[model samples]
Target: GAGLGDHIDRKEGQEHTFQNADPARRQLNQSFAVTDHCSKPLHTAISDRIAEGYTGTTAIRKDAVRALSLVFTGTHEDMKAIEADPEKLQGWLKANYQFVTQEFGKENVVRLALHLDEKTPHLHAVVVPLVEGKLTAKKLLGNRKDMSERQDRYAKAMEPFGLSRGVRGSKAVHNSEGWYLGQQQQAQKAVLSDLPKLTALDRINPARYEEKVQERFKFVSREKTDTAIELKRRTDQVRHAQASQHKAEQEAARHREATQSIAAQLLQAGKAGITLDSSYALLKAPAAIREAANTLFQEEVRKLADTHLKQGAEAYYRGIYQLEDSSKATREDYERHQKHDSEETRNHIAGEITRIFNQEIQQRWGVELSPEASLYKELRKKAADLVRELAKTILQELRKALGLEEPRQQRKSRGLGR
Candidate 1:
């Protein structure tokens, strides 16, 4: 029996942290307990381990939790498998212990106890926050983000044991086994709170109340159907929008290719004029011919640069629209499957795409542009590089056609434009 001042809800025959507490429970013989700090009972060992670490901090936080006690169990059906096979139960217990030991370093895991006496097998573990030889509960398990990650990691670790993590951000709240049972009883009572009066007139006139309830139910069903239809209609609209967006993107790409072709033609003309001038200079032609050739070459180079910039800007905008469509498609696919993508996954993919896009833009234009850039600058530097390469090839072919000795000065300034 519980003594004075003890919790009234503390039911009898409940298992405690102490070993060999239940005499009638035959499965207690199979129960196992372990601790790294001491051979003492589970509760005492956990307390001592935390107290020892507390010496490192001069000012202890009042709201801090020195140790975290976690209970690991499975659904009733999963438990049934363990009940049918003792080996299966032991395997589960070992997996839980291993997870605790690995997560919080083996030295920081104070105690692990498997309770076989309970109807459902569960392992209770006490982990002290002792990272870098200091007591820091906040560093261990203080925030919701860390807690969510812990759940994910635990679920992955328990995957081989056939356990799953609960839905993230669910409405269901955690409570002790006793508290759950009490809540269940309270809910059963609450279900009848709106019962009609049991008068003789009411008993004979229950049809009126039944009709009202039926009408309310019919209204709810109609609303549900309307909402579902609206959702389907919206889905179709998005698909149509995506198709139109893709078509627009293809047309924009063709326009950009045409613009780039114009730029290439201008670059080729400039290279040809420069090659002709160099040949004339080697053949000792008049200064008038060389000067005219230089002017034409400069004009062609300027025109080529302008066209290239226009082409790159157009291409950048095209990429932006295509990327937007891709993102919409990703979101629509998730909606179609009715599977919610975690914000973390979505953000990670978005970040990766943004990084790759920025790198491509920087390489193509020699300048990093913002994601929402309305105007892209001229890629004169890249255009010049392309023109220089083509000029080298043209220069080599012209030198072969003229059969003239290459001038020493020309050879010295051979790769100057590049």
Candidate 2:
């Protein structure tokens, strides 16, 4: 609540420091208690109401959420229309307050205030989220689905003022297609309003009325056709997005298969490609033979890098499965694990790769250990990858023959696995 009270300061008739607030218009703002319990000086009033309603056995924490402050308003243009007309302004205020009270019981409502001092006139309502005598914001505010339902309810309540629910991230001009349906609804309602009067013969002459209705009916028909087209276009966009996702997933699978195939080729190449001598022989070899030796070494390092990357992916899934098995996994937990574990895995593999590469560089190049040379930094970084595949394979085979190792289960993915 530290920064939450700035917009609400004007509601309590406090001196507003915000540039957008108008001091002169401050007198025009009106605040009302839903049941005459929570009065002016809104904070104290709200605290008292919560003290009365909260039925938790233990003392409430100072940081516990006691209320939900909802600001009800429309787009700039929508509010502009309501502000220009005194009647609609009051009607909207009444409608918003009623909707709030209905949704959160009147007993829970602390204060409803209309602020006329802002650029766009809006109503801010504070309601204590005391559900069955317990203060639980989750029970009252719920999740996104519940908030969406609230938007539908609020939009319907504001329909009489010709305002529709706005698209979440779209501008009014871009929302024209959705607005088309709202226009058709308004026109249809106008015609419906005229029908009962026409039945009594007290309305305008039947001929003119019929003509007016016919034109409106034509407009509604055209709008309906446009709305249908818009719906189809949006549906197609969703399908296109889903299809693109599926295609990307297939591409990834193919990439993994290609990598495995290439790794096998590299392993085979390492076994049969080139045999090297001491540094003396290597230095004496022709440039062509030296180039082949370099290529062979590079392939071996790459094979290790690719293998470590695969293992890291398997380790990530293993962690996710462990969390899921604990039954307390959350999206935030998964994201945090990915962020921290990725950096750690990269560093660990890089160190192992650098260590093995350096040992080979010293032995094969006939150079004494000068591991800290600035020359090795770039070389270490360039070759930093995984491990020596040939040695790893030989050791694994030895362990299998001696019954010192068991076959590992298939590489795991997210969720539960034996």
Give the runs in model 2 whose Cα sits over 4 Å from its true position. 1-17, 168-418
The TM-score that candidate 2 achieves is 0.39
lDDT of 2: 0.62
Candidate 1 lDDT by residue in tens digits, 105-213? 7777655655555545566566778777567777877598888898899998778767777667654455554454354345434544554555676666677876665
Model 2 clashing residue pairs (backbone): none
**Top candidate, metric lDDT:** 2
Point out the worst 10-residue segment of candidate 1 by lDDT. 1-10
Candidate 2 minimal-lDDT segment of 10 residues: 385-394
- Residue pairs in candidate 1 whose N, alpha carbon or C atoms collide under 3 angstroms: none
Writing each residue's lDDT as its tens digit, candidate 2 over 1-418 gives 3233444655344332233467888788787767665564556656777888888899888888777777777655778899899998989888987898888889988777788887677787778888898888889887978877887888899899998764543322443423644665576566556654457554648878876766656555555655665576566557666876999999778666655754564566568664345442335344444455556755654565455544543343344434423234455544454454454555555555556555655564554334685545644554333323322333344444444533445223323255
Q: How high is each candidate's TM-score?
A: 0.40, 0.39
